[model samples]
Target: MDKSYLDNLKFPASFFEDEVREGFLVTSMMKRYWASQLKVLSFVVQICDKYNLKWYAEYGTLLGTVRHGGYIPWDDDFDICMMRDDWNRFFEVAKKELPESFQVLTLSNNEEYEELIGRVVNCNVIDFGPEHMEKYYGCPYTVGIDLFPLDGIYPDEDKEKDRVARTRKVLKALTLAELADVNNHELYLLLKEIEKENKVVLPLNDKLKNKLRLLAERLYSECDVTECGNVALMPFYIPNNDHIFPRKLYEDIVELPFENVYLNVNARYDELLDLEYGDFLRVNKSGGVHEYPVYSGQESILAEHIGRNPYRYTLDANELLRSVQRYIMRMTRTVDKDTLPNAESMAGGSCADSGAVIKKKAVFLPCKAKWWKTMEPLWKKYMDDPGYEVHVLSIFYYDSDYNGNIGERHDERALFPEYVQVEDCEKFDFETIHPEVIVTQVPYDGFSTFMTVHEFFYSGNLQHFTDELIYIPYFEADAPIEKGDKAWTALSVMVEQEAVVNADKVIVSSDAMRSFYVDKMIELCGDETRMYWEQKVESFEKSAETEDDSGRINNEDDKSDMNAWNQFLGKYAGRKTIIYYITIAFLLRDTGKSIGKIRRALDTFSDSGDKVCAIIVPQEQILNDLANIDEALWKQFTDLVEKIKTTDNCIYDEKGFSLGYMDKWSGYYGDASPLVRKCVQAGIPVMIENIDI
Candidate 1:
């Protein structure tokens, strides 16, 4: 490496030449960035040479040294790697010997930095602008040289594998640990994945980062460098030969001209480049990783130093670094809600703080009363708790032909628990109420389904009215469907509904369903966003539970529905009961056979007059649009369903969905619909009958 001009590294006039190469103009700002980076590199070389430490150009730096005389024209950063031992020694020397203008930064020195490599940076910053625009700058932005450590491979194959794997995980442990904060999702799931990957438990606490750091230090440095013939960079390395390169590459070093001065290169730079990139001779500038003139995000301080060509003032290096540290601390510090930027107006673009309430509200937003079973338990939990004021906002909705033809207006607030407060959707101002939590059953944000909530009460827009928007699927997924199934297009839409996506939490019926949604989401957005979906979806074992298949409420009660169920039980004390399950699928798919089956099943069971009482359980959705659902088929079941009232032994339930077909159910009868799936799930040994249409 060139050291003759160490005290006065000359900036070449040719180095500042701007030329359009590869179809674009190379800006003067980019040339200045290269000059600043070379200056930082010279400082690092001086320190390493003084201490007898070794580092060779790596990554793009090596690529540039072998292919281009300097940085690959468009590349913005510089990289070099040293054997772990030399890396350690260089750090020790560079800290004490480097001048004030250059700052050696790593995880140890900078608390906010989470990068895997160490950096030697100029204390001064860099600014880049659109050729036409100006005045904006980035804070903490500066030209820097990245330093990576190459650790020796253990002689034992198993041992090397273990070391490489652990090192990779420890590096992951460091990065993942940094991601952990107050939000209990994303980073948290990855910690569990770490334990699964390496059997290492990284707990979330104050010292997790320190613990992982020490572990990484021990794992990488404990191996003897001289004993091992092979070495690899751990973060990029794995338990394979593909990433490991020859140890002799760094044993002998050669100098290569980089810009105006010669920089150190591995003696086997040819072979090293070939191993790193299959065709090292190929000139592909498409692989450049960072944005040109990458801003350090330290603009306020940079504005002062950027125009330093005339030397307007002398900067106090210590105080300047202190200012940077202060800015970093301010950026990284855990901020409280009141102190957060624009925090006062965080609530729906309003500046006035929503005042404290005596009792925070937990609103139950149900468009239809039948959908209440899924939300009733939560309402009860909040209702019984003194801390929350529970209200059932019986939201208004409309059933449509989806061509703008509104079929029926459903404002069913009649069956809610009388003991709980029922709010008038029109009069109970959501803005004034400012409920702490809002639980909605319908998640279809109009476009996904035929049902549409009153525009003012759409779940998608409700996010602005409350701090927490919770969505519980009003219906149940009897079984998961394959990705290519005909129903999946609509089902996928339901999964990604604005109500489901915008809500703070989505409570699903089962883990199987949750996994189904997650897998579907992966298909939709690729695997990168799986962690987000995992955290967003929740499986409910008990709380916010929905009713089971037999239209039976397991433990939840919608006062009037429960009363209707209990009243039906009173009349049929000594008789066998048949729950004739009816889903809209039956009416739509079975050429009026569902209507025929109900009659046949009822009449067949009614033959035993005093011994049996048949109950026709039509699915809840059939109640609203049954008449208009199929002008063709509605004529068949119209008179049959009404037989429940005229016949003494036959029973009809207003909210049959609110009841569970448990031990008392003698027969289960339904078409090949989702209710059959729910029947098998209930495990009630009721006789199954599928009548031939």
Candidate 2:
């Protein structure tokens, strides 16, 4: 590379004097440091590009671009700022994309490094610190660039000041807490003094950093950025000035050349520069008054000279590099031949050597084991046809007990054939596996990976991911709601409304469901978008032939092969069976009354002894909520069921034996349930409790 870029830059006389005193080459050191910074910036830019996150140059980096067309002669650090949302998104993507050479340091990740702003540090080289700064001295320190998050500020001046003041105090306390761990008594004492001076008590503890982080988040997110007049870098801790700038100045980005690479900067760079540094174009005399830390090319040499490396506690570079490489390869690698169409054709221009049209890629994300029944038919339809390639990513282990500690659900896995490929949520990579169409049953925030999809087909709730959105409304029973169930009901209604409003095409099982969702959309969004919602929603009746046996049959010959449901059914031979279903809502409301009614009804039927059996099935939610029920009510309900089970013709199957075993029953009697709709469609009579048959 040419060294000509550094030739024309003027250096202060003190710069050379300091280099002689510190025993390092001033010009060569700055050049090396600048190169290292550019490397980190390049890696950051690469990550942003891969993940579609936006970032811009800020502070010293921006100042250097306009005033010097590169690094300021005296400045050694690089700075970048992103809107709060982009900043968070970058961190999420960086978790997988950042190379080993770099480490993103924040208060949460490295408390000892204790700065509100995040830093992307180069791990390859160490910076030798000044002797007086005992904390950083003898530490292996890397040259790093600051990444400040610009958060929305309150529109009112007084509110903005109050927010800044509160955030600053928390930042001070957090810094002190970190210092306390390092045995920096003076700084800790200073924090106590500040607290005493302000007539408040702030504890120096481990939670200080998290408390500060939460406060900062609230300051940024409490107000809407677009509506607010100004945005500020809340954690910068600048005195007198709040560091707030006009929102317009930072909203749009423009490209500017820094060193050999072009980087994004605020569109109104002139105003931003002037606000931060008055007369920014003028070079400061007296060496700019900023401390310049000595840099070393070799880690061991710096370590030996300083007695220890300060950054040893930071992230491991080699491990991070390997992880980054794996992530990149996984993202760019060709899709497996079994799961996709021609790999070469998908990568290159055409679909096949025959010059046929390319097959589109579609992915299905089922949130639970039960959802597979709804999505599998569509998956098979596409899998059999050559016009499309299909893949399944399921959150099968979402049952509360299995969450966070996921184990193989062998039963759920058996639902798919060996030829079909299914990936669990934890292992699925959204960036690497690009799908043209995405079908999802649940729109919970847990499946954030689906946000990257181009064409989204939501079977239930709505998500704000794509314009090419398709909504498929599923059947959900409207059970009687108690006072505590109102929030759950409201959220369910909101999710459905959002799905209808954003849907480009809405598919429902019946005209009644279509009309119901349409009215909901109009209620939530008003009549202005009613025509659009009405035109998009259409009913698609489920095919009669598509219904499969509700329960998985085990015919392995061994006595142990029989499931509990089959074992329970085996007890009754040549008897007419009626299956009854119940939900958590039914149990939680009028607990004593509902149980009493059930007991009386079962006892009345048992007296006849007409060679009939009644099987009860409770949903999983009801079983799980058993622990939360009032102790008195739970005991009464359990005792009632026990008493009812004594009846010769009644069998209380509390383990939900009859849920998917409707095929084994002669008739159905239950509160309105999703299964009721299916049974009614299959020409089976359903006697709903509290409603006319």
Candidate 3:
């Protein structure tokens, strides 16, 4: 083996240099993810056909089918919605009727199979047949899937659709909130205790809790004022008394052909589908991993490459070997030895040149070179005489012309037989391409990321791909990007903030980002962390930090915590709160309203015996206005306040009638109003000082 090729090899930036390209790859991977999704959708069609069940591609999945003709390529999974009755019926059958390789997984079933919940439920779950079963073989975890149930709603010509839409949104929010809850166990316990103490009982128990949750969640999700009013005061609990889909929306169901399978689709699909996605019926042009490299500025090739690629490469192979062998020769080349560099030395040198040696010894794959060459010929001869298979992986991508100007090159290079396509690498059944050996063109640091897949390719069901496995990282693991450190830092911050208390404690601004965060958290916390409703608030509360729970003037210890906490709550008054606005208003309204109303609205906060309740009035005008209240009405209110008394609590804002100017701000109804701003500034929390009635 010679050192020329090893010396010549230099890291290439063409494959991994641009953030845009890398982002495109991420998007492309989603497309690949959907291929698996569509397969599941096709199966759903089969299930509906065989068992006579009715289903609709509801919500995003429905939007995808109607608009794009299949699963949304950008989407990582698929969903099907059924009426509540149909959902129950399907679950009954799916439990006993689904193929052994696949089954209906639900949030309710999280306890039985720990892996089926959290990010696992959020990941792609459609099996690509029995051959792909090994993907989950010994996984000890379940991946994500899609199935939504459409609950009953009261019939209304104008409001039903809006109600349905709102319900779906709420359901989604509940799902996200519950799944993100870190302290689910604690929350569940809290709810259990709360329920046990009261007979007036809000639904927060086990069997009935989920049902109650579905009901509350449904109401919260409702968008139509009419439908909400209809159900707002219904006597006793009603569980989806109305049909999941109104008769007008779904008059009849029809079957459609998809990938050789028949699927039941909503009858009015074309109009709705066309409206959302005009190209809703085309299959993908290609089926594999798409390479989208970032464009590197020539000045910072290494840094840009690191930024673009998930893995790193080893270019200085000769220098690497020399560094390792230098010590060897220095230590072994003694006076007693012939100094001839014996067969042992040659064997070691030959090992350096051979692919197997490189695969076993090299930390990362060597990059392709132009000028310099390695001792490949010598290594080839050494292996040929001794009987060893040699295969090397290389990446080919567009490069500049000789003039150094940016231009595309079209050189067709023979990739190593071991260089498996990324798509082929996805599934576990890798037996088709048999060889004595295999090599990867991946960088070193990225090795850990793909280690599981590679391990399966060699020792497990994929043994047919290679008789013997040779593992080399695509690039060196010690890339400059420091992703591992970033991850560690994130985890550290999470611990410090107690973000793990519930999933939502780690607030993400978008659903996509939320999904990513949830996946990472689940990966960190494993299956013991399931989703629950009670934990949702706790998690959200931590992230929001809008209230100072420690500010209660109860215990002496809490006093020290009160100053900063009160200031923090005051700060929250000026900022936008994404938390439930209506709930906040309803709770605060109790301060100026009847004692019974306050007690009913915020049972937990109302009973907290040692908390100061303040009604802030920033205007002298409002206070003067309050002084003009009817004496009899004021007396009645005073009596009510006395009955609703709690120690360590008060109704005065020491800041008094001093007011600050409020700039124009947005309101919950998506309107900008200076009057609303004035109300917020002068009469927020409550205008108790000015409430004459």
Candidate 4:
């Protein structure tokens, strides 16, 4: 390889002499370690660039770049920093894009690894030390790069000083807590006193470390650095020794060569580096070279000790590390035999183990007949699962004035086998069931059985007893169907937002549907809620087999009527069939304007002699509104209906036949409806009244 890159650097003779003395094994190991870290660095840099995230080389990594033109020759770690915004964004993007072998470690994510900074760990290779063995035990120790969040400091001098002081205090308390082991009675008593005074409980473990890290980051990020003139290198290694710099040093970023790739670095590196390390160029012989006990190719050792493949738990870094620690402690007898917790105890010995009585209760509530039809297959799956006791409940109360008359309690007994118990929510003892998983079609707090189910579950009241609130948001209403008054539309939006926010998991019909909800959730709720929902929300395209078959209607009577209607339309087979379906709410409220528009369009089609037959199916709601219509408007509507009925090429299907079965027909012409999407999906042409011809 080319050694020309190292020619400019004036290394002391001792450095090469020490390398020679250590032999080829140590030198080769160091080279491999550096190479691995560089690979990680490249991976991270590529992701940041793809996501448009700003990051810069920092600390020892930056020092190495400036002093050695690459890794410090002895250095084994890489460090980088991003502003809090960029840092958060990087993690969000990196979680999905990072290679399978690479794992992202953070304070919140990995319990055993306690640090304010995050790490991108390479699981393919093992790199651990004596300290790692002691702390991480059975965990798979891997090569990783550190990622620090550069937080903004308060512009106000006094406020900044106060913030730093408070952070230092928290850090001190955390350190003391860690040091206060079971043997250190005096230290433990001192920590207790400190905790009582500060009103901060300090547990000497991962929890305390996490709390302190959060506290420090929060305190540091209190002020907006972009708005302010200063920034702080927060969660710094030393307490009370925060390195504050002018925000200008961070604003202008420049790319610098580090190994084979270029890295983003603060433009004002001279000033920043000088502030960080006084006389940075003058390398102290003692401090310049640092070494740590690194164990290479210890994957087998980790796997053998942990009693499981270390790589399997890479995604769950915290648990992986904890397992490692526990295994090491068990092997070395470092932990007291009487005090040490058992595997069962550490594993929570609850629902995790097999053969444990699976008390998982799942309740599926179908608010409407259509919803029941859509979710029936899912109900059967849950029924088949021995682990789950599934309760299928239906609420059969419908408003007679609005939803037509509901008769016979809508029995679902015939749909399922005798083993399945289909109960009515009105009569069912929901309190006794005590369901852990609530699966509902009506996810919102709206004027539906959703409210009734919510009441039954005591949802959003008292303690949240339900474990998983799964919402199957199958219906996609892109725009408000309501005319004039937007109150109903607003209410619908609110309900959807509530469902998006509160539901533990949202099952969407398609990826398009998922994206729509994701955008809507983000718009309704902030970024944090959006992030939560993104993780929880998933897409499962409805099976074609589950969809209502073509020509199938709700009941036998409706089916016969639709068949007869189809037979009637068959007489006009020579003509192009145009299925005109419109909501009456829009028709009546538009003062006959919508109908007039349709009339004109139809007249034009007739005049053109295009051999087109129009089938106008008005919504049931429109038929109901006819009773309230004034004489003049009523006459106008009837005249239009009469004209269409009398016209040789037109037929009125009054029952408003199921749109799903309209595939045998030619095209759709009406106001935009959710059914239009279905028509498009079925390869039927759509012509909206005003928008499309």
Candidate 5:
């Protein structure tokens, strides 16, 4: 070796002299114990012979024979090496050939245990399960035979060197493999997968490792495994020449005396020994020179890498160390809802907060029911004014069997028993029951500012009505059902429809809920600010534009002369029309039906020769199922392509027979501007589905 090589190999007092010493000592003792385990070796040898495995004693086991005639007195382990091809063959044949007392411990013994084949282990005495050495030290321990496969080497010396230099790259990502059969440990399987050339990649951040492991598995499924090249095993030294004896006397086996046993050495023993210890057969004694435990032969080299990167090991570490830290800098940080910029960043649109205009009128305050006591404070803050004409839309008890018809059976007290009005909030348009602002309690904290900015920045029209739409995220905790499915469903519809794009901007009632939303939203979107506002603006603009009649208005003054909203009210004010159509439920719940019936329905209604109109389902899952249906059925459904509109209708409170009452109208609940515009442009006729009241 060059002088520079020696210098580079110099052991550090901190890492080598101390940390590595104990490991070496434990490993050496283990190897010695293993060598003395003649019964175990005899069994292994028999298995190898019976299976015609071309195996060789490896590491310290080989060293003991060459240097000390047998196991080094202090060594405690044994190892064997085999060429990849031979190892794979042995694994296949040994299953039925080996004695039942001793099974083939290779990974290929079972698909679930494949990782074990690539790992190096201290084979345990099968008679005694696992052995704990930490009783002698302060850590946990287990025993198993050490095995290393000799993989084919890349011919390029540089590439071979690069492969060796890369250490423990997949160490931190080991996981428990779900196996069908228990042939070996799960850790081994994880390691085996990583060792495959195609599986290696730069590790993700520590926090993402677990999730990435699943992702990696999925990704690996798409990779071709045959691309891996076979690399040579033990490339640096000649196999037949023991350097101490010179090439003239190279042999496969030679006799030597050990502490209490005699052993045979391979011809290249001296060459292999010299590479690991420098002075082969010179150290008549077997012990670690450093402060750490000694490892027999070149096994220490393998053990060092294994200790640091267990995923590369044939097995997984029983225990691991992890650290976590979290800190919150401040409390009760409130962002001004109106301050957010528009969404015009790169996307040429402003955030939803822009141009939000809410027109409010006198609102009548209804008497607070027992259930609404929790909402009194907010009502006072935003609605308890004398001028506010709070219109009391009929309030019915949850038990009230409200029929579809708006018959004159409304109880005044039940609807509006209390008349206390909020000084600021007002009501407008009792005929349409105009709801300029929506108020609800959100269940999280730290989103007041975010909620505000997200609410209106998209319209370039932030007006006071934006404030009227208050949200209290955290109210008293209620079951999802008790929370009023209708309310949350309505909320979801609004969001999905772009009715209120930045629903989070509405202040949540409970601090705890606010905090939850803040964390969850941050976790989901990463960039909470941009994502929250961007989505809101997009939805809001779409809704606003859909609600407008710009094409119909020839002049700005003419359009301004009459409120577009008023004109819309005048046109469709009380017109009730029956809407008979096939519902999406046909696909989802129509499981009992046959293909012929489905096709008939599709041919006539879904895809008539004249026009194709099909009932669209709200659930995408059902939609996908429809897409995957049999081709014949699909053809029938698609026959009337032109007449069919994929648009869907949104219905709420369908329990009461109120199909289309004057006081209650059902229209598209998504972005009004976009949805309306779509209908008008397509001449699709956006109408309330109802029987004329």
Candidate 6:
């Protein structure tokens, strides 16, 4: 490899002269750093040229290219963006094409960075102490060209809102995981809302953060840029849709001169600059995103570097050129071999990049957060090991007709522990993932609950997608099942289960339970397969009093959300709270009798001498959704709601109140619905009474 391109680079002595670009001083230090960054940009341009990839000058870089031919006088690193597909192509080649010291950084490879962007960098480690390194990716300065991925934009109003909302939620999740600025009011509120949506990424560690970064990547890639009319800026850290723009603006590319070489900029730069910033040709001396030369502090580190490495970085250009000529002839350089340069790239090119390097051994299904405890011991054993991976694909379930979801009634992802890499069943790709081992807690398949996993997720079907299937009964493993004939009856259904019979391994909570399973399976199999059944049925030997058991399921917001929950629950205190939840069943069929039931419940509570409090909670979104509906029966229902609010010993709860507050109620009087199951999961007593109207 030729090293001459890097050998002859120099910062001219004229840069030290009192010359200014945008009324800002062009210091020798800034010029030298730009020269170093331009070299890195040249290397990236080489790779992009080799692959025929596309990237456009963006943000301040775009403003600089039009107004200043290269970098703005006040800007630090260059800003660029590529369509996500192009970025993915770049990643494949970047790994091998980059020079030895050069590296492309993304959340995938760099834990220090939380943004969904990339940086093609060289050997430079800014030593800003541990605290600074932890917060600002080693100082607030841009180390290299910031490469943002532009993803596809959804045009349909609903789809666009959904796409933006999901990205924003994930952004909030990333913020909570980083906790970079817990004091930001907007961030604090968004994190509070995002965690309420899903807590699967809770108790965050380096691993779960990577999972979230990839999850957002998946969401961003949901739309194809080629088919879409617009492209969206990939990061949704801020709450706005203004980053989206028409795709036609970027269709034509013009490689304009940046420094020594050409870099990409949209051909319609005039219109874009006008649209983004009105009167873009004018000099904006104060709007640079970064502090000109230094990072946060007033210290000039680059100037210090110039004086520190006087051998080659001298302000005397003639002296540098003379030394270079002599050093080339001597065939040896005096610079230290290990000194950290300012991200200086040489050639064509974290916690150790956990995103790309690691792969999980299996995907586990816990159904809901509570069932996770059933397989947790084994899960931790595999998770703690370096080579194994466990993805908690929290699969949702519905009845045969798809009427009611069995578990995960509400957003159970919020109750999940942090550090667990959890995702929804909708994103699960059995064919693509092709997990080596599938440890499932549900065994009854399609028979027992009229409620089974989708045909694709059935354990019998899952057996085909995985090399090994392990069935650990949710009931026996977590807690004991029903006593006597009910136990035997449930076992009869469970023992003959396709999940149990076909599984490579069947785990039970106790040896006694394992013995019963082995004996029962052997009896069902004509006693000829006693040895097979015994070997298949193993036990975790977990004691009846499960030590260190998880308490996440019952108490969704034990402490993290105590403030939010207590504030909601303060009104109905000092009494036995009973939730009278109204379901959406009335939307389909309203007979007026259900409204009568609601009135009776509230009246009975009022007459109980204020000892009991009844909360009328509605699952229907009709409160805000009702408009231009003049139905007489519905009018009576609305009147009842108003009465409940003002009546003694009663409260009308809004739809968005935390389920945690509802779970704290002593009893539930509601329809046999998802909310009822949620109450059951919380171990609160329940009576299924319908509110029809």
Q: Which candidate has the top score in TM-score?
A: 1
Decoy 6 TM-score against native: 0.38
lDDT of 2: 0.54
Give the alpha carbon lDDT tens digit for every residue of 527-617 in model 3.
3433421222211111222123212223453454444444634633433321101111122223355334433423433344543232322
Candidate 1 vs 6: which has more TM-score: 1
Per-residue accuracy of model 4 over 571-621 as CA lDDT, tens digit each:
775566788876543454346365678677667656646477887787554
lDDT of each: 0.62, 0.54, 0.33, 0.57, 0.33, 0.61
- If both were scored by lDDT, which would come out higher, candidate 5 or candidate 6? 6
As for model 5, its CA RMSD to the true structure in angstroms is 32.1
TM-score of each: 0.39, 0.35, 0.30, 0.36, 0.25, 0.38
Candidate 3's C-alpha runs over 4 A off are 1-23, 26-43, 63-71, 100-141, 151-153, 156-211, 217-267, 270-693
> What is candidate 2's TM-score against the reference?
0.35
Of the candidates shown, which would achieve the greatest lDDT relative to the real structure?
1
TM-score: the better of candidates 1 and 4: 1
Q: Single out the weakest 10-residue window by summed lDDT for candidate 1.
A: 131-140
Poorest stretch of ten by lDDT in candidate 4? 16-25
State each candidate's clash count. 17, 6, 38, 5, 117, 8
- lDDT of each residue in 595-631, candidate 2, tens digit only: 6666666776688476778877765545444445456
Sort every candidate by TM-score, greatest first. 1, 6, 4, 2, 3, 5
Full-model lDDT, candidate 6: 0.61
